[model samples]
Target: MENTRFNPVQLRRARIARGKTMTVLAKETGISRQMISNYELGKTIPSGNYLVKLISNLNFPKSYFSSGQASNLHGATFFRSQSAATKRARDMQSVRLSFQNDIYSVLSRYVNFPKVDIPEPLDMNVREMTDEIVKSMAMQIRERWGLGTSTPVDDVIRTAEVHGIIVVKTNMTNDKLDAVSEVIGGRPFIMLTDNGESSVRRRFNVAHELGHLVLHAGVESIHDFTTQQLKNTIERQANLFASTFLMPDEAFTESLLSTSLEYYVKMKKYWKTSIQSMVYKTYQLHLINDDQKLYLNKRISWNKWRRVEPLDDMLKVEEPTLFQKVFRMIVDNGIMSEADLLSELKLPFDELECSLGIKLNNKMAVSEPKLRLL
Candidate 1:
């Protein structure tokens, strides 16, 4: 094969996107670790068989490394449990984001994706973001989206995607990191763990991440919260935002009907929210007394509903379809062949399949000629 000059940055991205250390990549490619490091550092370029070995091991097309586009994350990510996630796991997630950026870049060439529609950050310091302010912001967002207080958001994932928020569902090794959100290249991207979580919980998670994008976008880092109180306040604010966004005051309060946990259970089918979430929302809205809230918590714990709640099977998971639609458009319109699209993506077919939650098959057939009628 002819030698191709590869970009060191793309090489490193492909390696890290696979969550492989330099040593592991070297072992797979039958190359020295130092040589791989040298290639990534731009000290030396891989050529001939060395380049072929790297491409085969990385599963990226030769053009991917030669392409000038760079994968860069612009802002911080708000992890669900920042302290519980290891630094290695976070770094791997960043690499995954970089790969996603690359995929988006390719898709942009063929389709006009919706511009991100998140509201402007509120004019308040992080220290001044109280629960009331957060609730107000959530209500304002609902209004801006034309979602009336009483209407239940049927598909939160689709809602976000329609507003240009890229939602990715992937299997993460760190179970503590339930979901994460970030602003990359001025666009918001959210990643949810594909761990068989209930639809209600996933919708809440998406709303929670949206809270971070809207509320905490100004904060440089969560680590800046030196005190535990500050950290708790930030998280509490996001939680409040999620609750308020999902169940607005006017509708949720009227639907309260009763303070019993069973009442919340029956309401869950309508609201598409978890019973536990409704209980907390009720308490936050002062519909239930402190003792009532405690009783509901005990009931939840005693019945083992904390992990597996009721009606979990009934609510369907909201899968994203924008990317799939764009991919199909490009292929069906003959803009690009499936093989070419896969090559441009620089991702393994299986990996892309898992990321998009769809299958890719080459079964295009031409129609047979019709016989003339006598």
Candidate 2:
């Protein structure tokens, strides 16, 4: 029944995190668009009935609007296909990243998450980056991570989590954006799309984002590359990193017994890589001549295997469970109630579920046991 103090930035974050425009939020909450804009701009504050309505609609605790530290994705964010993505889509993902950072901040108080373990920054000039240099960079990373050339990465998401990289799967349905990675608070964070892509493609996407984090650490902004040539070069470097990182030369070359599509299909299960990727890697390694490579491409196009491939359903999709497990520990160990956790996060039930890829059964109170007196 009283007025509550509101932070304009928090209000804006809540709206962006929900992917709602001013008019849409206004209609949903029965508030005027002008008033919402004024509140977000710090010109005024919501009070009494309006404040209650905001709390109910935003699903944020009243305290959240009053006191909280705000963090943003400060470093460069490498979208898979930046040119194809719209500005609104990028902003929505950025808001989602900020929300994830807030969650990480809350969890850090109770649990110690893994420390970030990205490789040292490369000293090569972006303009002079060659395929050979990129391949060597990938090799160095493998050595640093203790991943041998022959060893296949069983689960890229788990590997990243263990190495202190926070991986989140987002519910962004945009086909143009496969994934994006950034550095925040001196840590690496990657967000993958939950677009029902095959596990193999998902793994490659994770690796590709990792490539951006390592290769473009010093670049200011992805858009800073004004020339299409420069942009293509950097993207090519990341692609090379992903290819070499996933399929090392020695082991991958050894497995290439033939240049036929059928051979690659059989090898797909062993490498856990898409047949197309394997075909490309084979050509990159020069195991198959250009003619052979062109023929293979024609075959892939003929069968439409570019979009869907064999063994796509068989390979298990890697997911991040660390955050969900930590949340469960906080509740199950009595560190915090589900209500408190949700309130602290300022996320609605559906958003929380989507962000963490887990369901929330909010009935989390522990029941007291009866005592028997003999």
Candidate 3:
């Protein structure tokens, strides 16, 4: 049954998930911006023709608007793009994150997901962290996870999932956002933008977020109690962690015969990391001087290898199986059908697929969300 009682939080969530700002939604719904705000703020609920406009425009089940207990995340959410992604964009992403969490909450009861196995954040703040410390943490965790320095992480995504971290890819369609990680319902979930890039690129991005999960505790956003320099420090430290974890110090140093672009390009296959990242790693390790680093960068730009690196096309991108298996076990095994989900959870079809990282195939199977234009 449709919920006539409008819950403002859910209204705000629908607006954000639909990627419509209030002004845009106002124009689309043929309603005043202030009125839209009023409805979302719960000062007054949209009713009658106003409600019809909202239902038609926003495109969420009417029941969703009044779904009980729309939980909000207050934890520190780490984004790959700090300065690039706008606040509104991040808010939209967060709303989706909450929706995904709800999906997880419902499905998890039926499926016992793997126990989370990542190490705790280091006992230090961003201010107290150092380059050496960050690298050390990365190495330690590798050994802890039974991955010694030299072994190429053939499937970092699977490694993360096996260890209890939820990884999913969604098409945020924003170049700025490569990945985002937030601890939801006491589980750390990493959302990678479903950009069809190199597996090497995906590996680095996942490692980068893993760095945040391990090294940067008590430091979530740039807006936190951190100066821009501290933010840069954490960001760079994460990069260092990614590099060190993927290309361990001892093994990688031995592998670096030359700082030339050709040498790193060849090494990319062995390391299963990007040539660009490997070049920067060589410089960061001080194995290559400024002039050599400058020369390599020039080579990268000259060949246009910065964006699409050599062999990026050949390397298969890693896929997250945890969520896929969860859904398969649930729906494929007849625990719940798509219609059952809509009837029970009141989820938007497209949003549900994106959140769970699985398509329902037949959107027509679910009942039309009791939302129609009058």
Model 3: residues >4 Å from true position, as ranges? Answer: 1-4, 225-227, 363-365, 369-374
Q: Among all windows of ten consecutive residues in candidate 1, which has the lowest summed lDDT?
A: 364-373
Which residue pairs in candidate 2 collide?
none
> What is candidate 2's lDDT per residue for 1-374, written digit by digit as tens?
12246778888887876668889889989999999999999899886677677767776656667655477778578887676777777777877777677778887788888877777756556777678877887888788788887878878888888889889877567787788888888878888766788999899999888888888777777777854753477777888899888888998988788778998898888888898888888877778889988999999999999899988888898888778878888889999887777766655556667676777675521121222323
lDDT, candidates in the order shown? 0.78, 0.79, 0.79
Superposed model 2: Cα runs more than 4 Å off = 1-4, 27-30, 51-64, 123-125, 226-231, 362-374
Error of 2 at 297 (Å): 1.7
How well does model 2 score by local distance difference test? Answer: 0.79
Count clashes in each candidate, considering only residues at least 3 apart in sequence or on different chains: 0, 0, 0
TM-score against native, each model: 0.87, 0.89, 0.93
Candidate 2: worst 10 consecutive residues by lDDT? 364-373
Deviation of model 1 at 92, angstroms: 1.6
- Global fold similarity of model 1 (TM-score): 0.87
C-alpha positional error of residue 1 in candidate 1 after TM-score superposition, expressed in Å: 22
Model 1 whole-model lDDT (C-alpha atoms): 0.78
